[model samples]
Target: MNLSKYLLIGLGVLSLHSCDDFLGNKPKGYTIPEKFEDYSKLLNSSYLMSSSNTVLAYLTDDLYRTSRGEIMNENAEGKLIEYTEFNFSGCDDHERNLYTFKHGQVLTAGNSDPLWNNAYENIYVYNAVANNILNVPDATKEQREAKYAEALVGRAFEYLNLVNIFGNHYDPKTAGTDYGVPILLSEVVGDGASYVRNTVAEVYDQIISDLKTATPLLPEVATNVYHPSQTIGYAFQARMFLYMGDYENALKNANEALKLNDELLDMKPYTTTYSTFGRIVLESNPDETFPEDVDNVENIFMRNLNGAGSGFYTAVVASEDLLETFKRHLAPDGVDMRLRLFFATDEANFTMNPSATPEKFKGYSTYAPYITQNAGFTTPEIYLIAAECEARIGSVSRALQLLDQLRDARIKNNVHYVEETDAPNRTEALRLVIDERRREFAMQGAPRLIDLKRLNREDWFRKDIVHSADGETWTLPANDLRYIMPIPQTVLDFNPDMPQYDR
Candidate 1:
């Protein structure tokens, strides 16, 4: 039979009650899924496995937009033709608006936000499996339980991303009233479906509940990285607690995840001395140097940025601040394995117009036939969460030890790697953990922007982010309402009663 047709029909049926018009169209085929295998196919679909929220990267401080003078082209005569009127290079209007924190209409009224759309679309698939898997005719009890568990975990993952982007940071005092994205647990969308926003606390409560319920049902390790396991369940719990500022639970869950799989990918093997650049550079082909998500031992769960090859991973340059973080943490021999493996100067790998000076730009390296930048749970992330929690409530020495352990793997040859002898006070240790988090997760996903939101809760961590273009500057002050992204205009237009965050 035709599997693709059935897949489309299954998804189309699931989307019948979709809140937005994007998924309203009925498919041409009318086949309804009846076999256990049909529901299994829906869960294992590539659309569910590979979906991502890449647009959130534009709202972070990790990227830099090149100035007008830097965006140049050359004629046949080899003379440079600069676009004096253009403000930034290699970025479109939407990216420019997000990068500069424009006050109004970052996304046009009729347009959809991929971050919002991809998330809810994937949610529908998860809800389908979660709501109906047990009743499927031929599945064994164990098999049905496992699929249901996976769906719950997947739905929790999407809700976590949504709430973090669209809602206020989880302030225990205010979260009860703070608006979060709508919570839809069932696949049954009807014409009268309610699309009102849930409170931040309510949404987080649902995430925690889903994870707790799924933990026992999950296997110790998943069959593949795209599927959730007991380890990922714990890892996601740790992430949820970290965002909520619950240190004890975060550390407990983080350690639980690490106990299962704490391996970090050693980067030394991926580097080589290049005579052309007179320094160590990453192996230009990432397919050889970097393992695919399924094969990567570091990943507990894997969700890639959509169109990773052509989107944020390759198109934009690293901000000067982010590059400086790498520079400051360089080993005595001026080598950082992460810097070599993940970032490259324009001279090393030019991605802009030829006439632009190659020496002036540095972007996240995308030397590959395909790119898979994981935005999900990983061992290092858990280690960092554990370390940060230790710094906050447990032990400074333990925090330093964890940081040093991760650093030992990333720093070249362990040249300047020293054990934790002179431990800083708790405040300084926490600062170090926060800094290391930035270095590790720069431009990977929405971590930096989310970090800004959560960290701003403390007086010491509160700081303004400034962005400049075309001789104009925008400063997003700590705890600014802009940190909470407004509801997508299309979402608002469709659900008129839906409240939007004030910018």
Candidate 2:
């Protein structure tokens, strides 16, 4: 494999650089961190952006191009093609880059953009901690074990997301041959070390192995949501199992997570106002003086989105399909309270600078899934997982009971079971639970897109789904390789030994 410029920049684990220097500037008199405290600090740095990434949101059905016409917020920096992802009737050659292994602007090799960079970079950090922290002479065994467990859990989480984001969904039959991302558990030691990609199954095994081994070593709950805790570990395991289509294990781990933290944010209190625009206007100066109580409850292990370019996912208009879906769940008084709680509407008093054309921005709203999608597991997500698993295991009644627990909080006047056509049989119950998941986790961008990929393996949607916008449409067939992003050509070029998926 040819050496990559990105590798020289991002993969230098042995000779470290300061936070400000990406060009390998060795700060004056710097030394490798040898204290347990130093490695603990390293663990903290990786969790900074573990909470939410909006770039992944573009791949889901919850996003749509406006019907009036496609229009870029004059000042939007990420480019209009970034938003045209899900609904791209008029996407031209330039805008079609997202359909390949490389999701963002192909840089001059060393400066690959954020979406794929964030996860892998954190893995490197965790690997550094896990590989060297054990040698800290000043650390006690308990302290060493605890920090080791955290690094293991963190590495597992990063690898899990990396494989799903860069590799194909796990197909048991083909996983042995399917390409997952590189399994870089240890720090780089040799010169010109060409990294080889592991199979999807190998990657999943490592993730599960790390999580299970770390569970007993981790604290029952972290002092705060910013770091790993037993609950977060269990929650992540539940997520992994669900994605792997292991419903029994998914339900078991979700139940374990619930035991640790089962609180859900009630959408009722926050329903007093409705806006499609969200709390802040797009392209406006960000509102930073914000922090609320709701962020603590179900978000079991809170984290932040560390990537600099991680913003714009919430700046666009809500999909018309999403808007209409919310309308169908209206209460007896004809209101779906979630609409007000989850969206910042154009009808709201929020201001849009330079103002968008009315036809282009009418009914515009931004997605507000939680107080914000900062990071961590939510109580509601676990319940939905349990409910879906229940239906998958042929317990429709139990599933509806669990589904009601969520709907009662989101819909006013006790609008029960998501909608009137809720699920009658186990198949429909599972479908309803999945439907509710799309509604519940929209703008979240993680579970929804992952759900689409994993479910397609079972041929969940019999027919292809069409995404229509601005008088043009694109069809996405079930289990298509497009569902899984290709390993970036830059990555492939860097490591010729790495395997490529079908795409």
Clashes of each: 1, 16
* lDDT for model 1: 0.71
lDDT of 2 at 136: 86
lDDT of 1 at 163: 94
Candidate 1, run of 10 with poorest lDDT: 1-10
TM-score list, all predictions: 0.86, 0.80
| Tens digits of lDDT, candidate 2, 1-503 | 11122342234332232332332353411344667766766665543435436555555666654544354433335444323322344433322333222333323444444545666667656776777777889878867877888878878877887788777788788888888877877555345667777889999999988988888888765646766778877789888888888889999999898888787655554432222233422223334212342344667765554321213433445777667767664566755555665565653333343353322233466654334554456778889989989888847777888888888777767656633367766777877777778777666665666777887766555434456555656776776666676565556555766656554
Candidate 2, residue 179: lDDT = 82
RMSD of each: 5.7, 6.5
lDDT of residue 260 for candidate 1: 89
Per-residue error (Å), model 1, residue 22: 23
Best by TM-score: 1
Candidate 1 residues lying further than 4 Å off, grouped into runs, are 1-32, 71-90, 272-287, 349-370, 415-423
